[model samples]
Target: MSKIEKLLKKLCNPAYKQNVRKEELESILNHFFEGQWTFGEISGSHNYRIYHPYFKNFPEKFGPEGFLTIPVSGGKFIKHFYIKILCRFINEIKEIEK
Candidate 1:
């Protein structure tokens, strides 16, 4: 009935899955860094580190290369972070449905 609910319903549709793929993720990151973006202003604005502990220790283990590594600390944290954000977003969508 509300605008948020309507938007969320659209996002929940299976057709939008393709937009959430890895390539789309990479494109978003690239666009963000290229534009010198910051946090706390996006649609899914949450402290990802709070939900994922590995992100907290990333800088210590990999230094500059930590974020670039895959399936380790950085990669795992990113994967988990994205999932959490997506879920949270979906929940918001559900709330709008109500």
Candidate 2:
């Protein structure tokens, strides 16, 4: 299994399903931002760009498409973008739930 699969499994584990404090969430993001953490598609050597492309114009071509991404630097470095987008998406979702 890939690291992302492992991470997703671990994250989905019922044991970790609890309210995450604001500080805790910030700490996790900060850790990754500071290059102190490494997991899945995120790394310290690349620049990532994230996009939330709107497919409302063509719903048939794309269904409920929310996010799109591309890497401008660090070829073959998709993890950086994945981590960035994932973290941002999670934080946003949490905020909405709160």
Q: How many backbone collisions does model 2 have?
A: 3
TM-score of predicted structure 2:
0.26
The predictions' CA RMSDs to the true structure, in order, are: 11.7, 13.4
The weakest ten consecutive residues by lDDT in model 2 span 47-56
TM for every model, in the order presented, reads: 0.26, 0.26
Compared with the true structure, all predictions reach lDDT values of: 0.38, 0.40
- Model 2 residue runs over 4 Å out of place are 1-62, 65-78
- lDDT tens per residue, model 2, 1-98: 75544554444454554433333333444433344223335665333322233323344543455323333323342333344445545455457558
